[model samples]
Target: MMTNPTKMERRRALQDSLNDRINFIKSVEEIFNCHMVNFITGNLWDKHIPEPIKEEVAQLGEEKVLELIYHFGSCNSKLEVKMELTAPCPTLSKYLIACRQYYYDMTDPSINDEESIRSEILNDSSTSVSDADDNIKKRNLSSQYLTPAKKRHEVDVMSSFIAKMYEKKLANQGIIGAIVDIGGGKGYLGSALALRYGLRVLGIDVASDVTDAAKSRNDKICRKLSEKCSFYQQKTVFVTPNTDLGNLVKEFQFLWGSVTRVALVGLHTCGNLGASNIELFAATKTTDVPVTILCNVGCCYNLLDEKYLPEGVIDKAHYCLPPLLHGHSVDLPLDETSGFPMSDFLCQRQFWLGRNARNLASQSVERVMSQKKVAVDALFHRAVLQTVLLDYAENCSDTVQKKLLSKLDEMMVVGKGVGRVYKRNASLNLHEYLKTAFEKLDLDIQLPVEEVDKLSERYDCFKSKIKIFYLIRIFLAPVIESIILLDRLLYLLEKGINEAYLVRLFDPLISPRCFALVALK
Candidate 1:
């Protein structure tokens, strides 16, 4: 018999576990830093960002550039370091604040009452005399810029933050790529991303109404984007809507060539759409595309069965889920509609069990406790009770039955007082007996000995793998969303397109939102 752990022991264990995880994260950060520094020191920026953006990034001196890189690395590693090199700050939010201060110093001289602009620049420099002095200077700067100057500073900082990521690539070329938005309802997110990053977007969805809506929305966006880009060199925003993705992918590959990036921008692509994207990423090719990054925020995982795809393509091995085992011969099951093959006996068993549980609960609740009074709505318990009354009422304890009767007596009085004395044939003891039966039935059915043994063997082998996969699924929303992110990351890895200088505009931790995928390359 194992004893439960003490609170202090559990706490200590948790702390130690956290320390280990943090150390692992630190190692990853160091490895990434070493690789990025070696890569970035070369002409990585030259190949990636624009010349003007490069000049702006160059404005930050060597030490300052390293500081920015370090900050970026920390951010990438999910660390909360905010103070500049001049100060070892404690707070995480302070970093954003410091960046805002850096921008304020750049744009608004009125607020920063330094003796000279040169002095202010020097104070903002990495070579600032002391942390105390820098803090004092920053305080003075903050005191001066109270209103409109502060707003301008914020925008400048944000733009600069975004610009740094694209500094190397944006300078060299206009976006020489296409972004395919899967199930992009009105194509707002994709359209916005394209407009922001200077990429052409193609929104794909099965619904013609949504496609038509996206077309209308894109037309308006084009007019606005055209006006915005008119001052700069010409860049067009094209929106292709209402294309049936079932067969159009091959046609698109033939026409515009394969897009470099595919974005599933949360228009709620359900079951089949996700499975299709996985297939597309594995197969689709384009002339311009070296490899493609897929960014999806998917919903409705339950729907992505064998029926969601074209007939005769999906391999037996590339199952959306794993297959099952049997006594005789393991055979693949065909879908109800498609008559296509799928093999997942375990999954079917699980689904059946869930359905049975719900049905049994409903039926059981209806029986012993006639819908007479409003009391404890213990549906599950009631189901068990009905099962017991039919099967195992003889084994029930008299003490348990008496305990239930007491509640029934009180309910009867209350029911009469409320002008609704609905009487039923079943007594409180019977209800309690039924509840006991239900509990017993659950234990009997849910963890059958053979199933438990099979599960145990699998668990012993793949416990860690199972934990990681479950964590990824549980902590993240809809399966499609995780799939989309993983697809993009895999695409990046496969294409050798690793030097992604990207900024997460939406803070994931704070807002519980995901950042949009913007590929500068």
Candidate 2:
């Protein structure tokens, strides 16, 4: 699309901003993408991001810094107006805030509201999972929803939206089939749709054990809803582009007769699953599967396959997971056809999001801030350990080094590379942490006390240097997410699917990966 910078600049509705998405991305790609490596690699203060940018972010009021990252997205209306760009900011911080300004409010009060959706449906529609059933009324949902209110809220909102969309689709197209929960982990959202909306749902996940677990959980929900309304079923399927679409639909119809339409949905389809779902929905128009709607919330941008660089060409030594997996998709060969930059718009430019940047995109500012303090310098701690390991490999005897460095390339890439995530445990001291880290790695070699002491001394200054830079990265987290979601939205629009929308379906506080890509045909 829409290429006008001035028009894209003015805050507009999500619908209006759809036109300029690719152009805005173009404007910021050079601005933000350059730092993808530095964020992942250690020594960001000196290596990648300019020193001035770090200084500005560190020096600013915490409120201002917090405002830059969290305020401009879909869920909150805390800010009355966009922060002024009149005052100069370091080029990175300024554009990061500005990029967020374009995000369509998730609670966007548009015609797509629930009342409007109800209006589109036929009057006197009667089928339902008895809303007043005492069994359901009496049982506590804490077990099904788990501990948090977030999952409950997400289920309540998403079920209502999916029910509305299905009813609307039924009225407009006369298509009536079950909602196929693609990559439906645990099946809570899909199960709730069936139990609450009286809609049939089939949740497909990858593992048989997961399928078994989903049914085990569904049994808990079904017990409350009464046996008659037990409409949710979980099946295992690795959903690729070439998956048996007609067969899946047949299975849906076979189980429940009079099935003519299917709505594809997912609550949190991680990484490639999310991208692949979009591709499947777009391609299903002419297929035997009479699909009318697609709703998905994608997370784990880090796991999403990036087309810009092939996996082979990229250095594995710069990666974190080897013995442990990054995700299920990594087991499969990298397919440029499946992951990020799905739309041709960015594909033409060969837009690149290095693995580290994509990994950084997965961070939730809300989750991190909830801990009171920045929690732990998990990144800082990991960075220092990686340096020690690298130094050990280089300086130690060949035999000792080989013992420590087995599959080192496949090991966690820490220095001038990336690291694994850790929980905030502020009480940890460097020596204690090193003792525990060595145990986990199972390294028998002894490290010098002097080296450990030197690193301990460096921790204070290193964390300070890295602190502001990390926040800035956290600030850009959603902006990176924006680019990914926008590309998918643009893909739908380009296919001439006019009814699609990027709905901010869940509360960000509870469900951090809250944006759901919803499209109706």
lDDT of 2 by residue, 384-481 (tens): 77666666666778787666565353453322222333435345666666766777777765657776788868655666555555655565566667
lDDT of 1 by residue, 1-521 (tens): 53434434433432333233234323322211111111211222344333443453345434453344344323332345444542432221232333223222211222111223223223343332212122211111121211354333332232222222222233234433444556666655444444444444556666777777766665665564453321111112221222223233334444445434332223334544643443344344443343233333333433334433323322121111112211111223444532111112212322111111111211211111122222322322232222223222224355544433332222221211112112355434323433344353332323344543553453243222222211111211211122223333323323333322112232233222222233322
Relative to the true structure, candidate 1 reaches a TM of: 0.31
How much does each candidate deviate from the true structure in C-alpha RMSD?
24.1, 7.1
Among these predictions, the greatest TM-score belongs to 2
Output the lDDT of residue 189, model 1. Answer: 45
Q: Per-residue lDDT for 443 in model 1?
A: 27
Model 1 ranges off by over 4 Å? 1-175, 194-198, 220-269, 282-291, 306-521
